[model samples]
Target: MAMNRVQFQSGLSLPAFLARFGTEAQCEDAVARLRWPEGFRCPRCAHDQAMAFRRAGTPYWQCKACSHQASLRAGTLMEQSKLPLRTWLLAMYLLGQSKTNVSALELMRHLGVSYPAAWRLKHKLMQAMLQDELPRMLKQVVQLDDAYLGGERNGGKAGRGSENKRPFVVAVQTDEQGRPLYAAMDTVPGFTRKALAQWLAQRVRPEADVYSDGLGAFRAAEVAHAHTVVEGEGRSRCEAPSLRWVNVVLSNLKRSLDGAYHAFGFFKYAERYLAETAWRFNRRFHLEYLVPSLLRATVHCKPWSEATLRGVPTFRTEASC
Candidate 1:
């Protein structure tokens, strides 16, 4: 739709957003239009010209031939969710529009839900957004580095013996005009050649030029691509104009964790936050397009189970709750 920044910012207002997509019916109609841009076809029986009927106040489509029924929320992030469609859309807008970040507490106040419910909703939507905007493997010149997070108990020590405090995150990505692209972060026991190689192998595209500091762990990266080490004082080789950008990314991440979550236990969920930041950074110029594109993309991806969504082991007692 070629949504510019002005349009994106203005469109997010409750009144304006509701004006276009106010009611659940209107939102469902938009979803149906987006999902079946061509026409309605029975998902189960492949029947065309399905008749839609409201069952118990909810709209349902039934195939005339096979009588297969499908609800508007079927196969979507909204599927099985208790929250209203307008609320979900508003949350998406807040996530997209905010410059710093919106906290679960703030969202709770905004959506008028309980803290736990709001937390779960935010996490789930963040996961969906993460899945929606899976970054393409970075090409051309790529920058690599590692950052330590959550290690205050050991007097800010980053490596060994700080396991309980915070784990290290190995990051690799490119910077295009101050925006990070294709960034990937992995929790590691410590930053090492093996860990760096593993992260690179999984997230980086082979044959792309790689740049990094003069770290021996990054030496093996040359096997896959042209590697250059930017040495000398004050020379930040990575995407940022200086090493400051990485610090900024880290500070923002820490602030988000501190203000919203208030602990390091949610590190698993923190990855989704990083993914969200990466999505925002990559699509900063076209946020409106990005948001809707993500909403649309979530439809095609496989639905995440509650167990995975909660980040609990299937065999664990926590999952029983």
Candidate 2:
């Protein structure tokens, strides 16, 4: 039989990545090709032709008709950056391929860059990956659960009541055979029926069935689709086959967060970190596509800075979008 897409596929090896993106020009060419496959059209005027202008080692284009200029990184997440394209590509490779949490320190060591630069690059990429999650509706059957991050602080109240814990929901949609299909996760102000309704409207197809433990908020699931409330007994609840993927996913999420980031603040950065986890899990099968896919997403998003990444988080509210 041919290889199944479900099986994990190896991504670009270090040697392969080095060979392909060894030089600044090579990385720039790759980005340009991925960003505009057919040809370089003026993003402003939609003109099809431009004159090449040199910038550092990369090339920018001046539109012949409008004289509008745009750089390779100019309309992308990398806009206004001083770093080379090769450095950015290498960072993408390391972050994309690493199965576990790789810290900014690791990135600094790997890229031979300063601590601050590495940290900025790492957070930028993480923010990019988080936004890269497409607004896909989960269909058929979905496993829904409420989860919390933080509260590891000793001497504080633990579990749901802790002030330190930030609550979020995990929803994983599965195929008819129960294989995992797609997942959606995000931070919520609280696990209320109203919150569930908002999340359902955003992430769930109105026709799909939602499986969850007996939570009052989940009952609101009926407002959109069929809701089956199943409360398992004891450890069996956490190990139920119907909820297998979510359980495994939760376990891995905790491990990756704890293992990779030893001394980091979580309260301010929880959503981006969790979004990174969800993105990585959803794109697990096609490991090779992860880097290129993220690169494509970066091109579509507006440029942002480290200060903005730290300060201006785009919170989701129904009225806002």
Candidate 3:
């Protein structure tokens, strides 16, 4: 199963994808190939000339010298997972291809899995997609603003005034044309100085020029960077070459969230979805590059567990209790 990078990019049709890597046996072979590109090695003894065989119909590599056995799924995301590899691959494709966002219900129908299974699958992929490293700093002119996101209100105002229903999110980034180069979103209880500062410190680079409305939270940002505040009617920062691009960028962000993921809940999971959207927006033009990159990411990444997939808080029992 040596899949070429180009073949993967053209997009794997549902039937074709299943035909190639649908069965559990096919999946194990794919994982084995991915895990040991050159040859199999024993996990415990570090022996390369290990004899691999199936135990209980599951592939296990046994070290010839020490007879140590290890499953192919060990140390991989697919470890301890019952979901089919084809199902996982399809889920990844759907998540990657979707322009807006895909809901769990939608995923359930798409993958033909249970609602709970679909929900868990979607978040697990999202968790893997989240960039662990901090994004590169937004250089040049950066647009800074806050927007609220969540489900529609029962009888709320048409637009802009329906802020009460959803949580407020702050976004900061630079855009080239309509593509965001760097972006970070944070869910806030409300627009407060403390919340804004915490987000800025984490996402924004020091000494970057900051632009915003007359929000006092940005006032402290001046300590480490150049800060400009827009005030009064008809005041335009767009005159500045660096600041002008933010207009298109901001519009795209709003359109994406409003059109695609109409409503999202609190801060924790919201950030993951935001990151997912940002990845899509940033790579819109480079689909050829983006598709393979996502596939490669899936290779090393582990399948997310049910507990981690939900993003719900889990309580640990105290020894004292």
Give the TM-score of each candidate: 0.79, 0.91, 0.70
Candidate 1's TM-score = 0.79
| All candidates in order of lDDT, best leading | 2, 1, 3
Summarize candidate 3's per-residue lDDT along 132-246 as a digit string, tens digits. Answer: 2224346555567666655446786655455333344444465546334655544554567776665567666775777876767767567766888866433365444444445
List per-candidate RMSD values in Å: 5.5, 2.8, 7.3
- Please identify model 2 stretches exceeding 4 Å from their true place: 1-8, 152-163, 312-314, 318-321
Q: Would you list the C-alpha lDDT of every candidate in the order shown?
A: 0.63, 0.80, 0.61
Angstrom error of the Cα, residue 117, model 2: value is: 1.3
Lowest lDDT sum, 10 consecutive residues, model 3, at 312-321
Off by over 4 Å in 1: 1-15, 152-159, 164-182, 186-190, 232-248, 255-260, 312-321
CA shift of 223, model 3, Å? 2.4
- Scored by lDDT, model 1 comes in at 0.63
